[model samples]
Target: MVRSNDNITSIENIQQAFRGVDYICSKQIATTLYLAFRLNKPILVEGPAGVGKTDLAKKTASFLNLPLIRLQCYEGLDESKSLYEWKYGKQLLYTQILKDKLNDIVREKNNLAESLEAIHQYDDIFFSPRFLEPRPLLSALQQRKGSVLLIDEIDKSDDEFEAFLLEILSDFQISIPEIGTIAAKSTPYVFLTSNNTRELSDALKRRCLHLFIPFPDAQLERDIINIRVPDLGDSLRFQLVSFIQQIRKLDIKKLPSISETIDWARVLLLLHADCLNMEIVRSTLNVFLKFEDDIAVVNDRLYELTQQATKEGHA
Candidate 1:
Protein backbone atom coordinates (compact mmCIF):
# COMPACT_ATOMS: atom_id res chain seq x y z
CA MET A 1 0.00 0.00 0.00
CA VAL A 2 1.27 3.45 -0.81
CA ARG A 3 1.68 5.81 2.11
CA SER A 4 -0.32 9.05 2.29
CA ASN A 5 2.86 11.09 1.84
CA ASP A 6 3.13 9.62 -1.65
CA ASN A 7 -0.07 11.44 -2.71
CA ILE A 8 2.03 14.00 -4.57
CA THR A 9 3.70 11.27 -6.59
CA SER A 10 1.05 11.65 -9.29
CA ILE A 11 -2.31 13.22 -9.98
CA GLU A 12 -4.01 9.82 -9.70
CA ASN A 13 -2.57 9.42 -6.24
CA ILE A 14 -4.05 12.73 -5.17
CA GLN A 15 -7.41 11.63 -6.57
CA GLN A 16 -7.26 8.36 -4.68
CA ALA A 17 -6.31 10.17 -1.50
CA PHE A 18 -9.22 12.60 -1.85
CA ARG A 19 -11.53 9.68 -2.56
CA GLY A 20 -10.33 8.04 0.61
CA VAL A 21 -11.58 11.13 2.41
CA ASP A 22 -14.92 11.04 0.53
CA TYR A 23 -14.21 14.12 -1.59
CA ILE A 24 -14.95 13.53 -5.25
CA CYS A 25 -12.90 15.73 -7.56
CA SER A 26 -12.33 16.06 -11.30
CA LYS A 27 -9.12 15.47 -13.20
CA GLN A 28 -8.50 19.20 -13.61
CA ILE A 29 -8.73 19.85 -9.88
CA ALA A 30 -6.51 16.89 -9.02
CA THR A 31 -3.92 17.87 -11.61
CA THR A 32 -3.79 21.48 -10.45
CA LEU A 33 -3.39 20.46 -6.83
CA TYR A 34 -0.68 17.96 -7.79
CA LEU A 35 1.24 20.61 -9.68
CA ALA A 36 0.82 23.08 -6.82
CA PHE A 37 2.30 20.54 -4.41
CA ARG A 38 5.23 19.71 -6.68
CA LEU A 39 6.02 23.31 -7.56
CA ASN A 40 5.38 24.74 -4.08
CA LYS A 41 2.95 27.27 -5.50
CA PRO A 42 -0.28 28.52 -3.98
CA ILE A 43 -3.47 27.64 -5.89
CA LEU A 44 -5.88 30.47 -6.70
CA VAL A 45 -9.32 28.90 -7.12
CA GLU A 46 -11.90 31.14 -8.76
CA GLY A 47 -15.53 30.19 -9.09
CA PRO A 48 -19.06 31.10 -8.21
CA ALA A 49 -20.05 30.46 -4.63
CA GLY A 50 -20.88 26.91 -3.35
CA VAL A 51 -18.91 25.04 -6.03
CA GLY A 52 -16.50 23.35 -3.54
CA LYS A 53 -13.63 25.84 -3.68
CA THR A 54 -13.37 26.12 0.09
CA ASP A 55 -14.17 22.45 0.59
CA LEU A 56 -11.27 21.48 -1.68
CA ALA A 57 -8.75 23.00 0.70
CA LYS A 58 -10.43 21.40 3.72
CA LYS A 59 -10.52 17.96 2.08
CA THR A 60 -6.94 18.38 0.92
CA ALA A 61 -5.98 18.94 4.53
CA SER A 62 -8.04 15.94 5.66
CA PHE A 63 -6.43 13.60 3.11
CA LEU A 64 -2.96 14.95 3.78
CA ASN A 65 -3.46 14.72 7.58
CA LEU A 66 -2.28 18.29 8.05
CA PRO A 67 -3.70 21.02 10.23
CA LEU A 68 -5.95 23.38 8.31
CA ILE A 69 -5.60 27.06 9.09
CA ARG A 70 -8.04 29.42 7.41
CA LEU A 71 -7.94 33.21 7.11
CA GLN A 72 -11.32 34.55 6.02
CA CYS A 73 -10.92 37.66 3.89
CA TYR A 74 -13.26 40.62 3.61
CA GLU A 75 -13.18 44.36 2.98
CA GLY A 76 -10.52 46.26 4.95
CA LEU A 77 -8.50 43.13 5.90
CA ASP A 78 -4.89 43.91 6.84
CA GLU A 79 -1.59 42.33 7.89
CA SER A 80 -2.15 42.75 11.60
CA LYS A 81 -5.32 40.67 11.47
CA SER A 82 -4.34 37.97 8.96
CA LEU A 83 -0.64 37.73 9.72
CA TYR A 84 0.40 38.78 13.25
CA GLU A 85 0.00 41.35 16.01
CA TRP A 86 1.75 42.22 19.22
CA LYS A 87 0.15 41.28 22.56
CA TYR A 88 -0.07 44.74 24.01
CA GLY A 89 -2.15 43.71 27.02
CA LYS A 90 0.41 41.09 27.99
CA GLN A 91 3.21 43.58 27.51
CA LEU A 92 1.41 46.10 29.78
CA LEU A 93 0.92 43.46 32.48
CA TYR A 94 4.59 42.52 32.23
CA THR A 95 5.58 46.13 32.73
CA GLN A 96 3.61 46.30 35.97
CA ILE A 97 4.96 42.95 37.24
CA LEU A 98 8.54 43.84 36.41
CA LYS A 99 8.29 47.39 37.80
CA ASP A 100 10.65 46.75 40.74
CA LYS A 101 13.16 44.85 38.59
CA LEU A 102 13.05 47.59 35.96
CA ASN A 103 13.55 50.31 38.58
CA ASP A 104 16.46 48.40 40.19
CA ILE A 105 18.24 48.14 36.82
CA VAL A 106 17.79 51.89 36.18
CA ARG A 107 19.13 52.76 39.65
CA GLU A 108 22.08 50.37 39.36
CA LYS A 109 23.61 52.55 36.65
CA ASN A 110 26.11 55.18 37.85
CA ASN A 111 24.80 57.92 35.57
CA LEU A 112 21.64 58.83 33.63
CA ALA A 113 23.20 58.08 30.20
CA GLU A 114 24.28 54.54 31.28
CA SER A 115 20.88 53.81 32.91
CA LEU A 116 18.91 54.62 29.78
CA GLU A 117 21.24 52.46 27.68
CA ALA A 118 20.96 49.59 30.17
CA ILE A 119 17.12 49.71 30.07
CA HIS A 120 17.22 49.19 26.28
CA GLN A 121 18.33 45.59 26.80
CA TYR A 122 15.15 44.86 28.79
CA ASP A 123 13.13 46.68 26.13
CA ASP A 124 13.92 43.87 23.69
CA ILE A 125 12.12 41.35 25.96
CA PHE A 126 8.80 43.22 25.59
CA PHE A 127 8.84 42.71 21.82
CA SER A 128 10.19 39.15 21.84
CA PRO A 129 8.48 35.88 20.77
CA ARG A 130 6.53 35.62 24.00
CA PHE A 131 4.75 38.89 23.26
CA LEU A 132 4.08 38.01 19.62
CA GLU A 133 0.56 36.87 18.74
CA PRO A 134 0.52 34.68 15.66
CA ARG A 135 -2.48 34.90 13.41
CA PRO A 136 -3.53 32.35 10.74
CA LEU A 137 -0.72 33.13 8.26
CA LEU A 138 2.06 33.24 10.78
CA SER A 139 0.61 30.26 12.66
CA ALA A 140 0.65 28.24 9.43
CA LEU A 141 4.30 29.06 8.73
CA GLN A 142 5.20 28.19 12.29
CA GLN A 143 3.84 24.63 12.03
CA ARG A 144 6.75 22.19 12.25
CA LYS A 145 4.94 19.50 10.23
CA GLY A 146 3.56 21.91 7.62
CA SER A 147 -0.11 22.80 7.18
CA VAL A 148 -2.86 23.60 4.70
CA LEU A 149 -3.21 27.39 4.80
CA LEU A 150 -6.45 28.50 3.21
CA ILE A 151 -6.84 32.19 2.46
CA ASP A 152 -10.56 32.04 1.85
CA GLU A 153 -12.23 34.59 -0.41
CA ILE A 154 -9.24 36.66 -1.53
CA ASP A 155 -11.39 38.77 -3.83
CA LYS A 156 -13.32 40.03 -0.81
CA SER A 157 -10.15 41.64 0.54
CA ASP A 158 -8.72 45.00 -0.47
CA ASP A 159 -5.98 45.45 -3.09
CA GLU A 160 -3.45 46.33 -0.42
CA PHE A 161 -4.16 43.13 1.52
CA GLU A 162 -3.79 41.09 -1.64
CA ALA A 163 -0.44 42.78 -2.29
CA PHE A 164 0.59 42.03 1.28
CA LEU A 165 0.23 38.31 0.56
CA LEU A 166 2.70 38.38 -2.36
CA GLU A 167 5.80 38.16 -0.17
CA ILE A 168 4.54 35.12 1.72
CA LEU A 169 3.21 33.53 -1.48
CA SER A 170 6.57 33.95 -3.21
CA ASP A 171 9.01 33.16 -0.41
CA PHE A 172 6.91 31.60 2.42
CA GLN A 173 8.33 34.21 4.78
CA ILE A 174 7.11 37.31 6.60
CA SER A 175 9.09 40.30 7.87
CA ILE A 176 8.38 41.89 11.22
CA PRO A 177 9.52 45.40 12.05
CA GLU A 178 11.06 44.59 15.39
CA ILE A 179 11.72 40.86 14.98
CA GLY A 180 13.10 40.97 11.45
CA THR A 181 12.28 38.10 9.05
CA ILE A 182 10.69 34.76 9.84
CA ALA A 183 10.75 31.95 7.29
CA ALA A 184 8.47 28.92 7.23
CA LYS A 185 9.59 25.96 9.28
CA SER A 186 8.02 23.82 6.55
CA THR A 187 6.32 25.17 3.47
CA PRO A 188 2.54 25.06 3.79
CA TYR A 189 0.16 23.93 1.06
CA VAL A 190 -1.71 27.17 0.30
CA PHE A 191 -5.14 27.62 -1.28
CA LEU A 192 -6.77 30.99 -2.01
CA THR A 193 -10.41 30.94 -3.07
CA SER A 194 -12.24 33.70 -4.90
CA ASN A 195 -15.88 34.21 -5.80
CA ASN A 196 -15.05 36.59 -8.71
CA THR A 197 -16.80 39.41 -6.92
CA ARG A 198 -14.04 41.65 -8.25
CA GLU A 199 -11.16 41.25 -10.67
CA LEU A 200 -7.85 40.33 -9.04
CA SER A 201 -4.61 42.18 -9.72
CA ASP A 202 -2.22 40.85 -12.39
CA ALA A 203 0.81 41.01 -10.12
CA LEU A 204 -1.02 39.10 -7.37
CA LYS A 205 -2.14 36.52 -9.92
CA ARG A 206 1.38 35.90 -11.17
CA ARG A 207 2.74 34.32 -7.97
CA CYS A 208 0.31 31.40 -7.84
CA LEU A 209 -1.27 28.63 -9.91
CA HIS A 210 -4.85 29.30 -11.03
CA LEU A 211 -7.95 27.10 -11.27
CA PHE A 212 -11.64 27.67 -11.90
CA ILE A 213 -14.50 25.47 -10.67
CA PRO A 214 -17.74 26.05 -12.47
CA PHE A 215 -21.05 24.41 -11.64
CA PRO A 216 -20.70 20.75 -12.53
CA ASP A 217 -22.21 19.33 -15.70
CA ALA A 218 -25.01 16.78 -15.64
CA GLN A 219 -22.89 13.63 -15.31
CA LEU A 220 -20.48 15.21 -12.85
CA GLU A 221 -23.32 16.68 -10.83
CA ARG A 222 -24.98 13.28 -10.78
CA ASP A 223 -21.78 11.70 -9.51
CA ILE A 224 -21.43 14.39 -6.84
CA ILE A 225 -25.07 13.96 -5.82
CA ASN A 226 -24.54 10.22 -5.56
CA ILE A 227 -21.49 10.62 -3.37
CA ARG A 228 -22.94 13.34 -1.15
CA VAL A 229 -26.49 12.07 -0.80
CA PRO A 230 -26.09 8.31 -1.04
CA ASP A 231 -29.20 7.33 0.84
CA LEU A 232 -31.42 9.02 -1.76
CA GLY A 233 -32.89 6.38 -4.08
CA ASP A 234 -31.62 6.31 -7.67
CA SER A 235 -34.93 7.37 -9.15
CA LEU A 236 -35.26 10.35 -6.82
CA ARG A 237 -31.57 11.25 -7.20
CA PHE A 238 -31.88 11.30 -10.98
CA GLN A 239 -34.98 13.46 -10.90
CA LEU A 240 -33.43 15.79 -8.33
CA VAL A 241 -30.23 16.39 -10.29
CA SER A 242 -32.08 16.72 -13.57
CA PHE A 243 -34.39 19.32 -12.06
CA ILE A 244 -31.38 21.29 -10.79
CA GLN A 245 -29.70 21.12 -14.23
CA GLN A 246 -32.90 22.43 -15.77
CA ILE A 247 -33.13 25.15 -13.15
CA ARG A 248 -29.59 26.32 -13.95
CA LYS A 249 -30.69 26.93 -17.53
CA LEU A 250 -33.40 29.40 -16.63
CA ASP A 251 -32.91 33.14 -16.28
CA ILE A 252 -32.75 33.72 -12.54
CA LYS A 253 -30.96 35.76 -9.90
CA LYS A 254 -29.26 32.68 -8.42
CA LEU A 255 -28.90 29.20 -9.85
CA PRO A 256 -28.95 26.18 -7.60
CA SER A 257 -25.41 24.97 -6.96
CA ILE A 258 -24.13 21.55 -5.89
CA SER A 259 -24.54 22.30 -2.19
CA GLU A 260 -28.18 23.16 -2.60
CA THR A 261 -28.73 19.92 -4.49
CA ILE A 262 -27.21 17.91 -1.64
CA ASP A 263 -29.35 19.79 0.85
CA TRP A 264 -32.48 19.14 -1.18
CA ALA A 265 -31.63 15.46 -1.45
CA ARG A 266 -31.13 15.11 2.29
CA VAL A 267 -34.38 16.96 2.87
CA LEU A 268 -36.20 14.59 0.52
CA LEU A 269 -34.73 11.62 2.29
CA LEU A 270 -35.98 12.95 5.63
CA LEU A 271 -39.42 13.60 4.14
CA HIS A 272 -39.56 10.06 2.62
CA ALA A 273 -39.87 11.34 -0.94
CA ASP A 274 -39.33 8.53 -3.44
CA CYS A 275 -39.68 10.55 -6.63
CA LEU A 276 -40.32 14.00 -8.04
CA ASN A 277 -43.85 15.28 -8.26
CA MET A 278 -45.47 18.67 -8.86
CA GLU A 279 -46.55 19.21 -5.28
CA ILE A 280 -43.14 18.20 -3.86
CA VAL A 281 -41.21 20.45 -6.27
CA ARG A 282 -43.60 23.29 -5.56
CA SER A 283 -43.21 22.96 -1.83
CA THR A 284 -39.45 22.37 -1.95
CA LEU A 285 -38.64 25.06 -4.50
CA ASN A 286 -37.43 27.33 -1.73
CA VAL A 287 -34.76 24.78 -0.75
CA PHE A 288 -32.60 25.65 -3.75
CA LEU A 289 -33.75 29.02 -5.09
CA LYS A 290 -33.19 31.92 -2.68
CA PHE A 291 -34.97 34.83 -4.33
CA GLU A 292 -38.73 35.25 -4.35
CA ASP A 293 -38.52 36.43 -7.94
CA ASP A 294 -36.54 33.36 -8.94
CA ILE A 295 -38.98 31.07 -7.13
CA ALA A 296 -41.92 32.79 -8.88
CA VAL A 297 -40.14 32.28 -12.21
CA VAL A 298 -39.73 28.58 -11.45
CA ASN A 299 -43.34 28.40 -10.23
CA ASP A 300 -44.54 29.54 -13.64
CA ARG A 301 -42.66 26.60 -15.22
CA LEU A 302 -43.53 24.19 -12.43
CA TYR A 303 -45.44 21.76 -14.62
CA GLU A 304 -42.77 21.83 -17.32
CA LEU A 305 -39.92 21.14 -14.86
CA THR A 306 -41.72 18.37 -12.97
CA GLN A 307 -42.65 16.64 -16.23
CA GLN A 308 -39.12 16.83 -17.62
CA ALA A 309 -37.35 15.70 -14.44
CA THR A 310 -39.85 12.88 -13.86
CA LYS A 311 -39.43 11.70 -17.45
CA GLU A 312 -35.64 11.65 -17.03
CA GLY A 313 -35.96 9.77 -13.72
CA HIS A 314 -38.25 7.19 -15.28
CA ALA A 315 -35.91 6.76 -18.21
Candidate 2:
Protein backbone atom coordinates (compact mmCIF):
# COMPACT_ATOMS: atom_id res chain seq x y z
CA MET A 1 0.00 0.00 0.00
CA VAL A 2 3.04 2.24 0.44
CA ARG A 3 3.17 4.62 -2.51
CA SER A 4 6.13 4.46 -4.85
CA ASN A 5 6.88 4.69 -8.57
CA ASP A 6 6.13 0.95 -8.87
CA ASN A 7 3.06 -0.36 -10.73
CA ILE A 8 1.40 -1.73 -7.53
CA THR A 9 -0.73 1.36 -6.93
CA SER A 10 -3.89 -0.36 -8.13
CA ILE A 11 -5.32 -3.91 -8.33
CA GLU A 12 -4.50 -3.95 -12.04
CA ASN A 13 -0.86 -3.41 -11.11
CA ILE A 14 -0.56 -6.61 -9.01
CA GLN A 15 0.12 -8.73 -12.08
CA GLN A 16 3.13 -6.59 -13.01
CA ALA A 17 4.12 -6.20 -9.35
CA PHE A 18 4.48 -9.98 -9.14
CA ARG A 19 5.48 -10.52 -12.74
CA GLY A 20 7.28 -13.86 -12.71
CA VAL A 21 5.36 -15.65 -10.01
CA ASP A 22 2.22 -17.30 -11.45
CA TYR A 23 0.81 -18.81 -8.24
CA ILE A 24 -0.85 -15.64 -6.88
CA CYS A 25 -4.45 -16.51 -7.80
CA SER A 26 -6.85 -15.05 -5.27
CA LYS A 27 -8.39 -11.99 -6.90
CA GLN A 28 -9.77 -11.30 -3.44
CA ILE A 29 -6.26 -10.81 -2.01
CA ALA A 30 -5.26 -8.30 -4.70
CA THR A 31 -8.55 -6.48 -4.19
CA THR A 32 -8.01 -6.48 -0.40
CA LEU A 33 -4.54 -4.96 -0.66
CA TYR A 34 -5.74 -2.40 -3.20
CA LEU A 35 -8.71 -1.40 -1.07
CA ALA A 36 -6.56 -1.30 2.08
CA PHE A 37 -4.05 0.89 0.26
CA ARG A 38 -6.75 3.32 -0.80
CA LEU A 39 -8.42 3.31 2.63
CA ASN A 40 -5.21 3.35 4.73
CA LYS A 41 -6.23 0.19 6.56
CA PRO A 42 -3.76 -2.44 7.74
CA ILE A 43 -4.12 -5.78 5.89
CA LEU A 44 -4.34 -8.90 8.06
CA VAL A 45 -3.38 -12.19 6.37
CA GLU A 46 -4.37 -15.28 8.34
CA GLY A 47 -3.72 -18.87 7.36
CA PRO A 48 -1.83 -22.04 8.29
CA ALA A 49 1.95 -21.76 8.54
CA GLY A 50 4.00 -21.64 5.30
CA VAL A 51 1.06 -20.84 3.04
CA GLY A 52 2.70 -17.74 1.49
CA LYS A 53 1.38 -15.32 4.11
CA THR A 54 4.71 -13.73 4.97
CA ASP A 55 6.02 -13.97 1.41
CA LEU A 56 3.18 -11.77 0.17
CA ALA A 57 4.33 -8.95 2.43
CA LYS A 58 7.96 -9.33 1.34
CA LYS A 59 6.97 -9.40 -2.31
CA THR A 60 4.87 -6.28 -1.81
CA ALA A 61 7.80 -4.50 -0.20
CA SER A 62 10.07 -5.41 -3.10
CA PHE A 63 7.50 -4.27 -5.65
CA LEU A 64 6.87 -0.98 -3.85
CA ASN A 65 10.59 -0.19 -3.29
CA LEU A 66 9.91 0.37 0.42
CA PRO A 67 11.90 -1.20 3.20
CA LEU A 68 10.22 -4.25 4.68
CA ILE A 69 10.05 -3.63 8.43
CA ARG A 70 9.32 -7.05 9.95
CA LEU A 71 8.37 -7.54 13.60
CA GLN A 72 8.55 -11.26 14.29
CA CYS A 73 6.29 -11.91 17.26
CA TYR A 74 6.74 -14.46 20.01
CA GLU A 75 5.45 -15.21 23.50
CA GLY A 76 5.73 -12.52 26.19
CA LEU A 77 6.87 -9.65 23.90
CA ASP A 78 6.79 -6.37 25.86
CA GLU A 79 6.24 -2.70 25.03
CA SER A 80 9.85 -1.71 25.63
CA LYS A 81 11.06 -4.35 23.19
CA SER A 82 8.46 -3.53 20.52
CA LEU A 83 8.16 0.26 20.79
CA TYR A 84 11.23 1.96 22.35
CA GLU A 85 13.13 2.25 25.60
CA TRP A 86 15.60 4.73 27.08
CA LYS A 87 19.33 4.03 27.23
CA TYR A 88 19.91 3.84 31.00
CA GLY A 89 23.66 3.30 30.61
CA LYS A 90 24.06 6.64 28.84
CA GLN A 91 22.04 8.34 31.57
CA LEU A 92 24.29 6.82 34.22
CA LEU A 93 27.42 8.22 32.58
CA TYR A 94 25.98 11.77 32.66
CA THR A 95 25.28 11.35 36.38
CA GLN A 96 28.92 10.24 36.87
CA ILE A 97 30.16 13.48 35.19
CA LEU A 98 28.13 15.61 37.59
CA LYS A 99 29.68 13.63 40.48
CA ASP A 100 33.24 14.46 39.29
CA LYS A 101 32.61 18.26 38.99
CA LEU A 102 31.66 18.75 42.65
CA ASN A 103 34.26 20.51 44.95
CA ASP A 104 32.17 19.91 48.12
CA ILE A 105 30.83 16.41 48.72
CA VAL A 106 27.70 17.52 50.71
CA ARG A 107 26.73 20.19 48.20
CA GLU A 108 27.34 17.76 45.32
CA LYS A 109 25.13 15.18 47.03
CA ASN A 110 22.38 17.84 47.53
CA ASN A 111 22.67 18.91 43.89
CA LEU A 112 22.83 15.31 42.69
CA ALA A 113 19.06 14.82 43.25
CA GLU A 114 18.28 18.06 41.45
CA SER A 115 20.69 17.28 38.60
CA LEU A 116 19.19 13.78 38.12
CA GLU A 117 15.69 15.25 38.06
CA ALA A 118 16.74 17.77 35.40
CA ILE A 119 18.42 15.01 33.40
CA HIS A 120 15.30 12.86 33.67
CA GLN A 121 13.19 15.61 32.15
CA TYR A 122 15.34 15.54 28.97
CA ASP A 123 15.77 11.74 28.89
CA ASP A 124 15.64 11.77 25.09
CA ILE A 125 19.12 13.38 25.15
CA PHE A 126 20.58 10.09 26.44
CA PHE A 127 18.78 7.90 23.91
CA SER A 128 20.71 5.13 22.23
CA PRO A 129 21.83 5.85 18.67
CA ARG A 130 18.75 5.61 16.46
CA PHE A 131 20.48 3.05 14.22
CA LEU A 132 21.64 0.74 17.03
CA GLU A 133 18.38 -0.27 18.69
CA PRO A 134 15.37 0.85 16.72
CA ARG A 135 12.49 -1.56 17.11
CA PRO A 136 10.83 -2.64 13.82
CA LEU A 137 7.51 -0.93 14.50
CA LEU A 138 9.14 2.31 15.61
CA SER A 139 11.59 2.29 12.71
CA ALA A 140 8.72 2.06 10.22
CA LEU A 141 6.76 4.81 11.92
CA GLN A 142 9.75 7.15 12.11
CA GLN A 143 10.72 6.80 8.47
CA ARG A 144 9.96 9.81 6.25
CA LYS A 145 9.17 7.45 3.34
CA GLY A 146 6.30 4.99 3.57
CA SER A 147 7.32 1.45 4.63
CA VAL A 148 5.77 -1.99 4.62
CA LEU A 149 5.43 -3.07 8.26
CA LEU A 150 5.04 -6.84 8.48
CA ILE A 151 3.94 -8.12 11.89
CA ASP A 152 4.56 -11.83 11.38
CA GLU A 153 2.83 -14.47 13.50
CA ILE A 154 0.66 -12.26 15.68
CA ASP A 155 -1.06 -15.32 17.20
CA LYS A 156 2.19 -16.33 18.90
CA SER A 157 2.05 -13.20 21.06
CA ASP A 158 0.02 -12.85 24.23
CA ASP A 159 -3.03 -10.71 24.86
CA GLU A 160 -1.02 -7.99 26.58
CA PHE A 161 1.13 -7.41 23.51
CA GLU A 162 -1.96 -7.35 21.26
CA ALA A 163 -3.50 -4.74 23.56
CA PHE A 164 -0.30 -2.70 23.38
CA LEU A 165 -0.54 -2.56 19.58
CA LEU A 166 -4.09 -1.18 19.53
CA GLU A 167 -3.08 2.46 19.88
CA ILE A 168 -0.49 2.12 17.13
CA LEU A 169 -2.97 0.35 14.86
CA SER A 170 -5.61 2.98 15.41
CA ASP A 171 -3.47 6.12 15.31
CA PHE A 172 -0.15 4.93 13.80
CA GLN A 173 1.39 6.49 16.89
CA ILE A 174 3.47 4.85 19.57
CA SER A 175 3.71 6.62 22.95
CA ILE A 176 6.97 6.29 24.83
CA PRO A 177 6.85 7.63 28.39
CA GLU A 178 10.41 8.91 27.96
CA ILE A 179 9.95 10.49 24.50
CA GLY A 180 6.21 11.15 24.24
CA THR A 181 4.28 9.88 21.21
CA ILE A 182 6.07 9.07 17.95
CA ALA A 183 3.62 9.24 15.02
CA ALA A 184 4.22 7.72 11.61
CA LYS A 185 6.18 10.09 9.36
CA SER A 186 4.65 8.42 6.32
CA THR A 187 1.55 6.26 6.81
CA PRO A 188 3.01 2.77 6.61
CA TYR A 189 1.05 0.08 4.78
CA VAL A 190 0.80 -2.51 7.54
CA PHE A 191 0.51 -6.29 6.96
CA LEU A 192 -0.05 -8.66 9.85
CA THR A 193 0.25 -12.47 9.41
CA SER A 194 -1.09 -15.19 11.69
CA ASN A 195 -0.88 -18.98 11.45
CA ASN A 196 -4.13 -19.33 13.35
CA THR A 197 -2.54 -21.35 16.14
CA ARG A 198 -5.21 -19.67 18.19
CA GLU A 199 -8.12 -17.35 17.54
CA LEU A 200 -7.31 -13.66 17.92
CA SER A 201 -9.83 -11.31 19.47
CA ASP A 202 -12.41 -9.71 17.17
CA ALA A 203 -11.28 -6.30 18.34
CA LEU A 204 -7.88 -6.78 16.70
CA LYS A 205 -9.37 -8.16 13.47
CA ARG A 206 -11.81 -5.31 13.17
CA ARG A 207 -9.03 -2.73 12.96
CA CYS A 208 -7.67 -4.04 9.67
CA LEU A 209 -8.58 -5.45 6.24
CA HIS A 210 -8.68 -9.23 6.72
CA LEU A 211 -7.97 -12.08 4.29
CA PHE A 212 -7.54 -15.85 4.73
CA ILE A 213 -4.95 -17.74 2.74
CA PRO A 214 -5.18 -21.51 2.37
CA PHE A 215 -3.19 -24.25 0.66
CA PRO A 216 -3.10 -23.71 -3.07
CA ASP A 217 -4.99 -26.15 -5.24
CA ALA A 218 -3.20 -28.63 -7.52
CA GLN A 219 -2.77 -26.38 -10.55
CA LEU A 220 -1.76 -23.38 -8.44
CA GLU A 221 0.77 -25.45 -6.48
CA ARG A 222 2.26 -26.77 -9.71
CA ASP A 223 2.53 -23.25 -11.11
CA ILE A 224 4.16 -21.99 -7.92
CA ILE A 225 6.70 -24.82 -7.73
CA ASN A 226 7.58 -24.46 -11.41
CA ILE A 227 8.05 -20.70 -11.07
CA ARG A 228 10.10 -20.96 -7.89
CA VAL A 229 12.27 -23.89 -9.04
CA PRO A 230 12.40 -24.03 -12.79
CA ASP A 231 15.00 -26.75 -12.97
CA LEU A 232 12.47 -29.33 -11.86
CA GLY A 233 11.11 -31.54 -14.66
CA ASP A 234 7.39 -31.89 -15.35
CA SER A 235 7.10 -35.57 -14.31
CA LEU A 236 9.17 -35.10 -11.15
CA ARG A 237 7.38 -31.86 -10.21
CA PHE A 238 3.93 -33.42 -10.45
CA GLN A 239 5.05 -36.53 -8.56
CA LEU A 240 6.63 -34.52 -5.78
CA VAL A 241 3.66 -32.23 -5.24
CA SER A 242 1.15 -35.07 -5.56
CA PHE A 243 3.08 -37.02 -2.95
CA ILE A 244 2.95 -34.02 -0.62
CA GLN A 245 -0.79 -33.66 -1.08
CA GLN A 246 -1.24 -37.38 -0.29
CA ILE A 247 0.81 -37.00 2.87
CA ARG A 248 -1.31 -34.08 4.03
CA LYS A 249 -4.31 -36.43 4.14
CA LEU A 250 -2.80 -38.69 6.77
CA ASP A 251 -3.08 -37.62 10.40
CA ILE A 252 0.18 -36.02 11.44
CA LYS A 253 1.51 -33.34 13.78
CA LYS A 254 3.27 -31.36 11.03
CA LEU A 255 2.39 -31.64 7.39
CA PRO A 256 4.62 -30.05 4.77
CA SER A 257 3.33 -26.63 3.70
CA ILE A 258 3.66 -25.15 0.19
CA SER A 259 7.08 -23.74 1.08
CA GLU A 260 8.24 -27.16 2.23
CA THR A 261 6.91 -28.69 -0.98
CA ILE A 262 9.14 -26.30 -2.92
CA ASP A 263 12.09 -27.25 -0.71
CA TRP A 264 11.41 -30.93 -1.25
CA ALA A 265 11.42 -30.40 -5.00
CA ARG A 266 14.62 -28.38 -4.85
CA VAL A 267 16.28 -31.13 -2.86
CA LEU A 268 15.18 -33.63 -5.47
CA LEU A 269 16.52 -31.48 -8.30
CA LEU A 270 19.84 -30.95 -6.51
CA LEU A 271 20.29 -34.70 -6.07
CA HIS A 272 19.74 -35.27 -9.83
CA ALA A 273 16.70 -37.40 -9.25
CA ASP A 274 14.80 -36.99 -12.51
CA CYS A 275 12.07 -39.31 -11.33
CA LEU A 276 10.45 -40.36 -8.07
CA ASN A 277 12.08 -43.44 -6.56
CA MET A 278 12.29 -45.05 -3.14
CA GLU A 279 15.91 -44.01 -2.53
CA ILE A 280 15.28 -40.36 -3.44
CA VAL A 281 11.99 -40.24 -1.58
CA ARG A 282 13.46 -41.75 1.60
CA SER A 283 16.41 -39.38 1.69
CA THR A 284 14.26 -36.27 1.13
CA LEU A 285 11.48 -37.39 3.49
CA ASN A 286 13.25 -35.78 6.41
CA VAL A 287 13.13 -32.38 4.72
CA PHE A 288 9.35 -32.49 4.60
CA LEU A 289 8.47 -34.14 7.89
CA LYS A 290 10.06 -32.75 11.06
CA PHE A 291 8.84 -35.30 13.62
CA GLU A 292 10.35 -38.79 13.70
CA ASP A 293 6.98 -40.32 14.44
CA ASP A 294 5.42 -38.51 11.49
CA ILE A 295 8.12 -39.87 9.18
CA ALA A 296 7.59 -43.41 10.44
CA VAL A 297 3.87 -43.23 9.81
CA VAL A 298 4.38 -41.75 6.34
CA ASN A 299 6.81 -44.46 5.27
CA ASP A 300 4.00 -46.99 5.10
CA ARG A 301 1.69 -44.52 3.31
CA LEU A 302 4.45 -43.73 0.82
CA TYR A 303 4.80 -47.39 -0.10
CA GLU A 304 1.05 -47.65 -0.44
CA LEU A 305 0.86 -44.66 -2.81
CA THR A 306 3.70 -45.93 -4.94
CA GLN A 307 2.19 -49.41 -5.04
CA GLN A 308 -1.12 -47.94 -6.14
CA ALA A 309 0.68 -46.03 -8.87
CA THR A 310 2.39 -49.24 -10.05
CA LYS A 311 -0.94 -51.03 -10.21
CA GLU A 312 -2.58 -48.18 -12.10
CA GLY A 313 0.32 -48.20 -14.65
CA HIS A 314 1.14 -44.57 -13.74
CA ALA A 315 4.45 -45.32 -11.93
Best TM-score among the predictions, by candidate number = 1
Worst 10 residues of 1 by lDDT: 1-10
Give one digit per residue, the lDDT tens place, for model 1 in 196-287.
Answer: 88999998799989999999988888888888888889989889889999999999999888899889999899999999999988888899
Per-model TM-score, in order, reads 0.97, 0.84
| Model 1 ranges with Cα > 4 A deviation | 1-5
Model 2 off-target regions past 4 Å? 20-25, 98-133, 307-315
Q: Rate the local accuracy (lDDT) of all candidates.
A: 0.91, 0.78
Per-residue lDDT for 1-315 in model 2, tens only?
235544556776775557544446467778888888777889889877899899998888877778999999999888767876656665677757866443333344457787676555654555534413568888889778889999999999999899888888888988765456777888888999998888888889999989998877767787888889989988777777777777888899997899999888888888998777776787778998999999988887777765543333243
